[model samples]
Target: MHSIATPKLTASMLALALLLAGCATSPDFGETLETRSEQASAIAGDYKKGEKLIEAGRKDVREGRKLARKGENRVNRGEDRIREGEAMMAAARAAYCRDTGYATPECR
Candidate 1:
């Protein structure tokens, strides 16, 4: 009777071990390594300058949009719209430089 119980316990332990193994996830597939490396290389990449300008320009756009939304008069609304346009121009300039390595005079 003791021997029969020993075999049953051994079989249950093996089954539990297999089940625990199944719970383990594949390594690195669980994580998102958002490397911009490939995208950076694909672009003409003056890298730091282009990225910085884009960030600044995008911030300007967001601020201008917020201002436009708050504006009650035509004058205030016009000013905000002008700001948004300028921001878009700057962002375009940055993208052009990133793609072509130079900005057009108008973009500048």
Candidate 2:
């Protein structure tokens, strides 16, 4: 009985040793941690750059809106000026017809 138990104990000890050895030979945790740290830093840098770009885009949009409003105002003022000029021309044609008694093409 003693001889049989000795062999079983030795086999169990050998199996445990092999299992521990396999675990020890696996990938090094220190190297994996370092690689993950580098990847995280790169991601953080990209995120910061993206934030800056978004802010710049927002600024551009704001400036564009301001320019569009200015353009609209100019267009409105130009239209008003055109109406004033038309009224002035009409008045001049009426006066010319009254004074000369001549129905020129413009007076018509």
Candidate 1: residue 33 Cα off by (Å)? 99
Q: Which candidate leads the pack in lDDT? A: 2
Alpha-carbon RMSD to native, per candidate: 26.3, 20.4
Runs of candidate 1 with Cα error greater than 4 angstroms are 1-72, 103-108
TM-score of 1: 0.29
lDDT of 2: 0.69
Residue 59 displacement in candidate 1 (angstroms): 44
C-alpha RMSD (angstroms) for model 1:
26.3
List TM-score per model, in order: 0.29, 0.62
lDDT of 1 by residue, 27-56 (tens): 444432222223333332344456679899
Colliding pairs, model 2: none
Per-residue lDDT tens digits for candidate 2, residues 1-108, read 458545643333544544454455646655454454455455555666776898999999999999999999999999999999999998998899888776677656
lDDT of 2 at 49: 75
